[model samples]
Target: MHSPSVSHRNAVDQILRYLKSAPGKGLTFSKNRDLEVVGYTNADWAGSVTVRRSTSGYFTFVGGFKPEKPMELHCDNKSAIDIAHNPVQHDRTKHVEVDRHFIKEKLEKKISRLLFVKSEDQLTDILTKAVCGRVFYDSLTKLGIGDIYAPT
Candidate 1:
């Protein structure tokens, strides 16, 4: 969700800088880690003013996987959940519907339950993958991204 003229490469570089500058800085998966994935997923749902397409994003975990099982995705969209739950062939969602299959199957196999998270609570915002320095640093701290940045 950025400017139309912004090239993907530039975006990738920006994200890379934030990640690399703070080298060895990341959320590590360790036995002492007590936190769950606490993931968030979101889509603009017809967000493209030009194409009417949506962009979706979600984060997987603290360690990135839970017990070798997929993380249960929480979402605020009932319609998306409906589309995901049914998995029937439909026109409106057909374009971006492929991602829903995993969740649908997860539900059927009792592997996941789509919990509803309020928009404000979703942490997906911090993960634009490209952001300004201050914004990047703010998100970094918010996600507990640094012992590296902590004052010495």
Candidate 2:
């Protein structure tokens, strides 16, 4: 934030453009009786050509209002889901041991349950990737975002 660059400027411009395009679009969290919390998480491992670093994103929503029961976390990566469920450690999984253990702890405490979701159904993809137009709008609709100015 202290030092700005051309890339950062361009990114900001893009965000502004999106906001301008959807001036009345907003998310609606309706009152519900169910208290089960649902979440989606996705990671793009070593996706950047220059940095070779992973980009992780998650979308969590409380339908019932509170997490009275185990929070359902949907993920697209089978390996990550397996590692979170498995206790036996291997060198190959050491890189993500910290994250894995955190999730494992949550699973043990019944605070969260990690489950597999198809890539197409993973809502977090909109945050981590440049998806097709259909996917973009579909995800927004799923997330309860709507354009208030649209004709009824």
Candidate 3:
């Protein structure tokens, strides 16, 4: 921010516009019959061309009254999912060995189960990606976010 560029200013203005358009939109939790926790994880492998870094994200949903069962975690990256389950370390995944071991430990203790999910169905995309129009609205609905002023 030492020397702001035109692109940065435009991006900020766009965000402000979106915030103004959905000032009352927010998450609305409701009670349900089933008491369970579901989680979703996704990673954009080598998403940044400049730094060649991957972006990973996850979300957990606590349903009903209490924790009924081990949380179900859905992941879109097969390699990351495999790393979490496999105890043997490999050269490619050595950098993330700590994270792999942590998730593996959780799996062994039955704290959570890692499951595969299609990229299109991953609800956390809204938070991690710059999506708009139908895709954006769809993700918001799946995340239980709605406009308070809109009629049900």
Candidate 4:
């Protein structure tokens, strides 16, 4: 690296703080017969204070060894869900990137189904937003994450 600034140091500090705050956190999986796969996706549209660029993320969970049936994808943005379901492209959808059309293809093939979810219930928020502690822990719990080192 040629040069490092205060911003980099601050970022490292923030990461260290997060690690220290949750040292024992881990994911646990057990034997299960149902192999249902569910995914949650969200985008912070122009949520950045400095650059105003949208950032998106997704999280998926598989209950067993093999995924069964059509994968359920939950999204908080209704417009995105609509676009994914609509077969006919409109003028407004012209600006959407080419890669996004993959979702439409998947939908048409019955590989996945897109569903609308409320913002508060969007489990992907923990990955994309600086949510409060309550929301963060709740999301983690919903995702089957637990503290492995906790006393029994």
TM-score of each: 0.59, 0.90, 0.81, 0.84
Which sections of candidate 3 miss by over 4 Å? 1-12, 64-66
**For this target, which candidate reaches the highest lDDT against the unseen true structure?**
2
| Candidate number of the best TM-score | 2
lDDT of 3 at 111: 83
Sort by TM-score, top down from the best: 2, 4, 3, 1
Could you list the CA RMSD of all candidates, in the order they appear? 5.2, 1.8, 3.1, 2.8
Query: Candidate 1 — worst ten consecutive residues by lDDT sum?
Result: 28-37
Question: In order, what lDDT does every prediction score?
Answer: 0.65, 0.87, 0.82, 0.83
Candidate 3 or 1, higher lDDT? 3
Clashing pairs in 3: none
| Candidate 2 lDDT by residue in tens digits, 1-152 | 68777877998999999999889999887886887988898879788676696788988886755557899999998978888888898899888788788889999999998889999999999988889999999999999999999898
- Kindly give the stretch of ten consecutive residues in candidate 2 with the minimal lDDT sum: 60-69
lDDT of 3 by residue, 10-125 (tens): 97999899989888889998767878899987767787565686767788888865577878998777877888887788889878878888888889999889999998889878
* Alpha carbon lDDT at 58, candidate 3: 81
Q: Judge candidate 4 at residue 55 and give its lDDT.
A: 76
lDDT of 1 by residue, 1-152 (tens): 46445566787888699667767587633465443445667766576566776677787656544544545677777777777777476877677665667667778886666778776555565542334567656655656666655577
Return the number of clashes found in candidate 2: 2
Whichever of 3 and 4 has more TM-score, that candidate is 4
List model 4 lDDT by residue over 65-146, tens digit each: 5666889999988888877777788888887847469888888888889888999999989767799999988988888889
